[model samples]
Target: MPILWLTVIVLALAALGYVIGRRRALASGDGRIRNLHSLPSYYGSYVAMMTGVPAISLMLLWLLAQPFWVNSAVLADLPVSAVADGSSSSLVMSDVRRLADGLDRAVAQGVMTEADIDAMGSDLSGIRTRLGNVGVALGSDVSTDILTSAQDYRTKAATGRLVMSILVLAVAIVGFGWAYQRTHKDFRARNVVERGIRYVLIAAACIAILTTIGIVLSLVFNAIAFFRVYPASDFFFSLTWSPSFGGGSELGILPLLWGTFYISIIALLVAVPIGLFSAIYLAEYAGPKVRGVAKPLLEVLAGIPTIVYGLFALLTVGPFLLGIFGPDGVGWMQAGTAVITAGLVMGIMLIPFVSSLSDDIINAVPQALRDGSYGLGATKSETIRQVILPAALPGIVGAILLAASRAIGETMIVVLGAGAAARLDLNPFEAMTTVTAKIVSQLTGDADFSSPEALVAFALGMTLFIVTLGLNVFALYIVRKYREQYE
Candidate 1:
């Protein structure tokens, strides 16, 4: 409830601040306001941050401290033995608090029965008696009153925060209104607001960076823990992935890598040509009408969920392929649910990803370059082939690597499409498992996290993260180099 109110208060304050700032700036009628540094929302956001952030922060701090403070005060009133030797300050504190809450609930519900009071007494006694046995299992041992009082205090604090937030917004509005009324030729309201807003934007950017860092840190810790158990050599080098459950788990990651690479290879082979052609058609051949209609339609491929692709691989493509080579006509293929089926489906899925990006890069190529080549009597195809593709090549490479990242991170499609076998087989027709496949399977139903089998997921996740990061970095390098060429 406090969190909800805080959000509401923040937004209201922000909106009020924005409106006030905007009106003040508009009324100023100065060339400075017209040429003002930043967006109107910045001032509003600034005021909102000012009103809400500190208040909410203080509220949170108060909420955290209030319980301990209240609990300590109540415990001080109780007998020394009631403190239960401080063996379970943490546990007995909760017990005392619950007992206090129990008393309050009895009053709230109009239950004046001896049983209610007895219940509260039992809560107190339970803590003192169970002091020696204090551990994780113990919950609380207080009266209904103290807990209810705590809840009521928390509510009051939240309400106080809301009132303060609203007051701040009102102050902003009144201040701006009063200032606007006194708007002489020398008024600098816009400057004041814009300055405030720029800082707010900086804060937002910092927040995004911090969040990214936090996520990376979490993944790093887990990866470190995983490497502690499983040797790095086995994860990267060993080419025979055979993770175990009950028996001795070989935990080879090679087969998974092999499957992932195999599927990705087939997808890239299918996508590159098709995607490149589609991009060329859109950028060079298609009319504005055709381009307009086809571009979004092509992007629909990207919009389709990977799970849909997996289902297609499973129910549709898997069986069709199996029928074609099920030890009958030519026996070249093993089963319908093989690497090719998944790869082919995944390729189709990646088409829009490649085409759309390539289209943008290709379209970005200087029209003057094409015109220069054409003025020399080169054909349209020759001009485009000679000029556009070469210019867009780096961007195209980056796009492909971006698609590759999507392919590697893809779990649902492979989990459904690729066979659940950990064999290092050469045949694409044979069932092959990937890193993601092993991760998914290893963590299912009765997972033992401490065990090597369960810990394997972390190692595999780290591998996936590292691989994707490398791919992105390489793509960034290519894109940067390409951008420099044009610039």
Candidate 2:
């Protein structure tokens, strides 16, 4: 909560700084003649970036480290007997927290004698107060060892944040000042800023690339460990997915993949036509008011929680299908808990996902193409069908691919909607399971990490990552080439 407030405060300050800086720049500028500095917006943007980014970065770092630091401090205070064995960080932290709170409660309840109660209360209170005091302190407290540790954590945190903030501000100021100083007849500060922006974009791309590499490497290493025990052949081609409980287990991808493909294909079949037509109608037929009202209404589909979709699948669709297909009745559909039910519900969920993107891509098709088609006596549908769609094809394909990726990775809908039995089956109405569902099943209450059953999840994860990455790459490639053609 504090971190969110800090971020909001920083952003607000940045916006205010931007507004003030822009106003100052404009007021000082000679409107009739050129001035010696940047445009008003640049100065404002400079201040805004400086004000927001560094503080946000500090907040992010603080968020990541807070639990670790708090746990370490609490652990240091614990009596050695509390965590004598070499326990994991999670276990140790849990015990220390339990002990501290228990001591406080015992004291409150008069379970402990007065002397013990006083000392325990003092220790807990001292630790809490020192942690608070250390947050904004500099250098070290120097009063005592525990106090010094607290202060050191605080000082380092504060100093790091100060440094980052200064760096970002210095950059913004330098950019603004340089742009302002060079604002003469021949000066092209616009070009300079654009070039700087290009670099900024490249940096953003690098960050994404680095993150992808990190994720891939993490999955690969763990997958290698999984393969050490389980044969790759069995995992890939074995038609059954009966995960071993204790002694011996079989880890197979075929069943999970079967379920994943079944659900996704069903989702796509439902999503594509409805989504495409909606996009067409939005882009070509709607008035401004209709478009505005309808677009948001479509997006409301996206905002509906996945859990809701899951419940609709389970409670409504599943039982309905079960009633028709459960042997006593005419079976058009086999069962509600089958791939079709989850897929149909999920497809409804993804309509807006596809529609919104398809709308953007369809709109991007050149008006010239439509004009040419009309000149050739093409009707409205003909122009859209023949020229506009083909022109927008690559981008449309990209949009569908993006939606496909979302469907493939979807967790909650499958967990609630799809049955948990992992097995290969061609029947969509039959109970089926997906990779994500399997992951959840494997990691539940009695998970044994050393066992093959638990470790196979890494292999499943690796396969999922590779598949999604390939889809995204293909989409990006198609979009890039199409974008070039339009350019």
Best by TM-score: 1
Q: Considering every candidate listed, which one attains the maximal lDDT?
A: 2
Q: For all the candidates, what are their Cα RMSDs to the real structure?
A: 8.3, 8.3
Candidate 2 residue-wise lDDT at 466: 84
- Tens-digit lDDT string for candidate 1 (1-487): 3457655765675566556655554555463554544454444444554555555555555566656665565555444454454444444455555543454444445543435444544454443343323221324434433333434443444455565556544654554445445433344435755665676688789889998898788767777877787788877787666666775667777778888999998888888889989999999999999988998888888888888999999999988887777777568777677888889898999898899889888988888899899899999999878878888999999999999998887778788888888777778887776788777887896644566777778778877888999999999999889888876
Report the Cα lDDT for residue 3, model 2.
40
Model 2 lDDT per residue over 371-423, tens place: 99999999999998989998999999998898898899888889877778787
TM-scores vs. true structure, each candidate: 0.71, 0.68
Question: lDDT (0-100) at residue 207 of candidate 2?
Answer: 87
Least accurate 10 contiguous residues by lDDT in model 1:
129-138
Off by over 4 Å in 2: 1-213, 332-335
